[model samples]
Every structure is written in structure tokens, then in C-alpha cells.
Target: MIRKLFLIASLLAPLPAGAEPLANKLFAAEKSPSTQESMPIGTYAKGCAAGNVELPETGPTWQAMRLSRNRNFGQPTLVQFLEDLSVTATKIGWKGLYIGDMGQPRGGPMNSGHASHQIGLDADIWMLKPASLTLSRKEREKISSVAVRSADQRSVTKYYSPQHAALLKAAASDPRVDRIFVAAAVKIAMCKTAKASDTKWLQKIRPIYGHDTHFHVRLKCPAGASLCQTQKPSVSDLSKGGNGCDETLAYWVSDAYLNPPKPKPSKKPAKPRPPVKSARTYVLADLPSQCAAVLSSR
Candidate 1:
């Protein structure tokens, strides 16, 4: 019996060094194990599933699906959001407005599957344009000029239009917005417009370093996919002083306001030649004539 037990133990022993294990055999198994999984966005799932919408997939996925050329209207939720905003703007008497630069739809090189615009959920509404109105090139240029000229560097609140303020307020009130990146000046103007109750939404607008050209609206990624990678909302460090919005507004005024003072180029001095050492003196009696001749030759 002892001999039989020894034989069984030897058969079950680990393989020797440099030897391969059997392909289908298990050497050892753990009694307990741990696994990791990511949590899906429940809020997004609720909205998308109820709306009968699939999150827009652009780039390679679109190409693989062979629907590459379809005009992406944008994510259904985003379109709905825009519609709500547009209706509000119209009621308030804003005109000549249109969405701009939705970027490439899913499956284009420009989109690369991660573009905010490609998801059909993000749109750039031109602040300079009025709702349902079109502008000639010259007229558009004039509006740009007015935006620059009218902006005040000392006090942004003084120059911000009531129309612009209302638009921001409407966007902030939306529940789906993950965050909004606006010019510092615009953010400052928003703080003034925000009442105590509106502070919650006002806080969602994060002031980034360079948004003078346009505001960037980022939406929360819907559930069940890996694409949404936005960070959690935190109070903006830029808004700490209560003047960051004003500072940002002032900074966006125009070329006159935005441009920093040019630093003067520094001049370099001419390099000097290193000093030459004096020749060592040696008496003819202190060295052989041949050595002296060799040294002289060297």
C-alpha cells in the first residue's frame, strides 16, 4: 500500500525545469478567485433605451457596417437637446441661427470614432449667428467685428449681451449636459446671470484656458460602450477667485485684449579666444642636444 501511494504522489508531481506542461491538463486550480468589471452609465441607458436610440458609432465601425456616406444628424438625444434650445431661442427673439462644424460622421478619418461631433450628439451652435437666419460673408465678418469691438476688457459683465446670457442659461438647465467649456469671459458673465438657485447649473460650465473662439459642449457617454471617457465634474479651479470669469471675458475681447506683450529677444556676446601658454625654457646643458632637437621638431 505504501509503495502504491508513493507511485501516485510521483505521478502528480510538477513537471521538471525546461519541460512543457500537458496542453489539456491542469497543474493546479485556485479554490477562490476575483474578477473585475466596469459599471455602465445607468442614466444614459434609461434615456437611450426609452428613446429607441442606439448610440452613434462612427469611424471604423461605420465603415465596417457599410453605412459610411449617411448624413449623420447626430445622436437623437443631442438633436432633441438642440431642438429644445432652438425653440427657446426663437421665443426670445434671437434670429439667423444655425449649427456649425458637427465634424465627420462615424467612420471617417477625421472622426476616428472618438470625435465628439461624430457621435451625432454634439453640435457647435454659432453664438454669432441668429436663429433661422443666414448671413452673407461680408455680414458675417461684420458680426465678428462687433463681437471683438463690443467686448470690454475691464468688466466683461458690462458688455455681455442679454441674448448671449439667456442662451447659456438655457443650455445649463439641460439635465443631459456633462459639461460646457466656454471662454473665461463668457463664464464670468454667466456667474452674474446665475441666481442662487441657478448656481448648480452655472457650476457645470468649466472655464478652460482658450475658448474665446467658441464654446465646447461635451455630453455624457451613453451606457454599454467603452467610448465615453469624460472625467467626473469638479469645481473649476479657475473659478476660485470669483473673478476668473471676468478675467476670461476680458481676455477674449479682441486681438487688442488677447495678445500678450511680446518678450524682447536676448542678445549673445562675442566669444573670446583662450589664452596661449608661454613656451617652457630649457638650457642646452640640462638636456641632450638630440632630445632638444626632437622637442623643437615636435
Candidate 2:
């Protein structure tokens, strides 16, 4: 009994020294859903989930990787969307999606590798779909996702196939999906090949950086989420213009992008880099006021 008591106390202890408050230590300490009321607190980059559900590690058409990160938790809507998308992938001649991070158990900033997803409305779905869906947890951790970016890093490589466009089309078909971030090359490829009937779905596929291995999906804020904040109109609007493959894409392929300017050599010694604050570091006051109540609830 004393040993068990010691373990509990240790788990509740404050974070080690010099850690950034942006990746709030409290988020790592939370292991259970805070409430049954499904609501998001703020924007995807600055938010928390009041109630979250865990996506099972493996499903009929998909498998969640990096289980050790414990980021398989998300709002119920997000979880359902992923499961449904997995079925869509299977229908389009691919095995199924290999899922990446969703959000932390409490749905806040992470220690690393993402700027959004703090609100549980965002998910990263790997382009690599395992031929089989029965991979063990060990395999899930060891299997590396292949990068579909071309050697030049401006376009999709040979590994990217027509099936990828089909997959993205399926994901964007859902009205709930607000935006899907992919590389410039992928967007261009879709613009060139998408049929007339399918061009509208292309509007939701925005070109972004470093999504060679996975595409991020963000959902529209669910109905009746009063405290939930919506992103600016530009982000949510997909009908502003044609598929973004005109002069805008040229920027990604320009020398400025292909060969970025290096920093001028500093005369003085460089100052020490400051600590990075992740979503996990956000304190209750740093987030929506209601998040405090969410964190403290069951």
C-alpha cells in the first residue's frame, strides 16, 4: 500500500526544471476524459477538449501509430470522421490509412511536431496504408512512413499515385472537413488530373509545407459548441477562387523556395536559443477560461 501511494504521489509531482510552460505539464498528467459534454474550447492551435474519446489502436480499415505518444484521443466527431474515412480509403483500392497524431488526452499543445490539433478537430493521416490491417503495436511503432515528396521537394514523387488524389477526394467529400493541407506538388497534380465534376473538392486541398508523408484534415466546428471559436473566414472558405494551382503554385517552385536565402553570418556570437513552448505548456489562464473547469472536471 505504501509503494502504491508513493507511485501516485510521484505521478502528480511538478515538472522537471527548465521545461517550457507552453507544453503544459498538466496535460501529460491527465489520463482520462474531463467530461461527457463534447465541446472544443478555442482555435485548433490554442484550445482543449472538454470531452474526448480514444480511437482504438487498430480498426477494420486503419491503424494508429506511435501509440507511446498517447495522442490517439480526440473529440467524438473527429474520431468518427477518421473511422469513416478509413472505409473510404478501402473502397478506393488502397488498404487503409495509417494514422498519426490526433491530440493529447486533454487536447492541448504537444511537446513537439505540430502547431494545431490542440482542439481535437485536426488529424494527420499517413499516405502509407499498410497492406494488412492487423499490424501489431510493435510493428506500428517500427514501420516508417515513406515520403511522397519528390527529390526536388517541390512536387510529389513517383511514390505518389493517382490513388492519393482519390483518397483526398474522398476525405474532402465530407462537408465537415474544412481544409486538407498537402504539399505544393500534390495540389498541382490534382489540379492537372481532377475531372470537371471533381474540381470543386480540390478547393479544400490547400498547399502547405512538409506534408509529404501525411495530409492534415481539419473539421468545421461542430454545431452548438458555443464556447468553441471558429477560425478566420479565409481559412473556412473554399469557394473564393479556382483550385490554387495558378501563379500561387509558381512561388513554391521558385528559386526563393528551392534555394532559400541563408542567414547573414552574425558578427557577434549567437545568443542561446530560447525554450519552445508547446500546446502542452499552456496554463489554464493561457487558454479559454472554460478550459480550467474542463481540466478540473471528471
Candidate 3:
């Protein structure tokens, strides 16, 4: 009994001096929220959240996927937006939304999966139209979202449907959303149906690599939210009031990007640079000062 007690005590001992712990590990260990007011602190990719709330694993209009990951937590604004969107899904012929990771309980950098979800304002919604919202937790783990993009990455497959487009439109139209990310092929398909006079909603849907089976939604900082930060150059300014269906979109699926030419031979090979430190490398000192408090709060 004494030997077992000594081993347990050693495991609980504090880190040695001059050692800094990874912020992701620190946040992931927090299974419950902090005892503080709800607030998303710092930038989306590099911050923490206080008083984050967890979405019920199963709801009438939505089911949070990957239950064992314990990442269904988000700010109150995000939770409401998701619930509202799920109801919208029913109107669009889908049973409900199958939500993915939202954030860690305290909302800091994660050890895996994402970097932006650290703020509790970002979420991944599966592209698969759920036939049933009553999926058992075990089944949710085994089931996978259907891929909408073709393997060539130049166009969407038969899996991309009108209902999926409608769902994307509704989410982007929401006032709470700042931007959404989808596969470039999906956006190209969306562009073809957009009317010249009414395509402003498409501006919020940005194209990035991957996301063939899911779309990522990011919310704007809530009103009166303290310590929250937004990216520069508003989406409208970047889009110039036009739907994002221009040369930029074309370039994403172009051969120059999808099938790039080989680099020319060089006289000397370039030296490898040290890895840049980011969310995955950030220590407590690298994040917002208040993040330390959030991580330590009971």
C-alpha cells in the first residue's frame, strides 16, 4: 500500500523548474468549464475560452458526433446558432445536423484536429444529410460523413446535392457567422447557381483545401464580448461586394495548383528552416495573459 501511494504521489508532482507545459495538454485535461463569465479570449487560433457550455450529446434537431472526444463545448452564442441551424436543416429536407468538434471545455489549443476551434466560435458540420437523428453514440463513431468532392479535386461528385447547398446558404446567411470553409469544388458548384443580383450570401463561403466531407463555420465575436479579436480586412472588403466566384475560385481548381509543374534543378539545395512555433507549440506564456487564469480556474 505504501509503494502504490508513493507511485501515485510521484505522478501528481509538479513539473520541474525551467520546464514549460504544452498549452493543448493543459486545456484538454479540463473536462469541465471554468468558474467564470462566458468569454472567448484572444484570436481564434491562439486563445482560450471561459465559462464555455457543452451542447447536449443528443438534441431534437442535432446530434453532436464523436462523443468520446468530449469536444462539444462552445460559447452560448455558438450553441444557439447551431440549434437554430439544425431546425433550418429540417426545412431543407434533411433530418438534422451531425455536428463535429466545437472545442475543449476551456477552449484552448487542441492536441489534435484543429487550431481555430480554440476560441469556441468555430465548428465543423458534416456534409452528410442525416437520415436519422437518433444515432447511438457507438454508431456515431462508426458512421462517416459522405465526401462531396471528386477525387480529382476539380469538381464535386454526385454526393453534392441541392439540399446541401441550401443548408450552406442558411448557415452563411446567419448574422452570427463570420465565415464558412468548404471544398473549392463545392463553392464552384454553388457559384453556378448564384444570381448576379443576389449572391452576397456566397461571399461568406470561403474555399480551402480538404473539407470534402464537412464544412467549417466560424462565428463573429459576440456583442459586448471582452478580450475577443477578429481578423483584419473584412470579408466584404476582400470580396468587394461580389460573390467569391471569380479568378480566385478558378485558380484553386486550376492545373497550376492541382497539378503543379516540377521545380527546376538548383545549383544548391535550400537549407531547412526550424519549425515555426504555433498553436501546437504554444506554452502558457504564448497565449493571452488571461488564458493562464482560465486554465487554472476551478
Better of 1 and 2 by lDDT: 2
Please provide, for model 1 over 1-298, each residue's C-alpha lDDT reduced to its tens digit, 9 standing for 90 to 100.
6764664444345555535332111111111111112112112111111111232322211111112322233455655566566667765566423444332222111212222242334545555534224344344334431231124332344334777777777786787777776666667667776675446567657665534544556566655545334455565553553323444444555466567678687597657888642111112222222211211211
**lDDT against the true structure, each candidate:** 0.42, 0.80, 0.89
- Better structure of 1 and 3 per TM-score: 3
Worst 10-residue stretch by lDDT in candidate 1? Answer: 26-35
Ten contiguous residues minimizing lDDT sum, candidate 2: 232-241
Off by over 4 Å in 3: 1-18, 234-239, 269-274
> How does each model score on TM-score?
0.48, 0.85, 0.92
Top candidate on TM-score is 3
Clashes of each: 19, 9, 0
Give the better candidate number (1 or 3) by lDDT.
3
Clashes of 2: 9
Report the C-alpha lDDT of model 3 over 77-185, residue by residue, as the tens digit: 9999999999999998888999998999999999998878988899999998898889999999999999999999999999999999999999999989999999999
**What ranges in model 1 sit over 4 Å off?**
1-73, 107-118, 129-159, 224-226, 234-298
Candidate number with greatest lDDT: 3
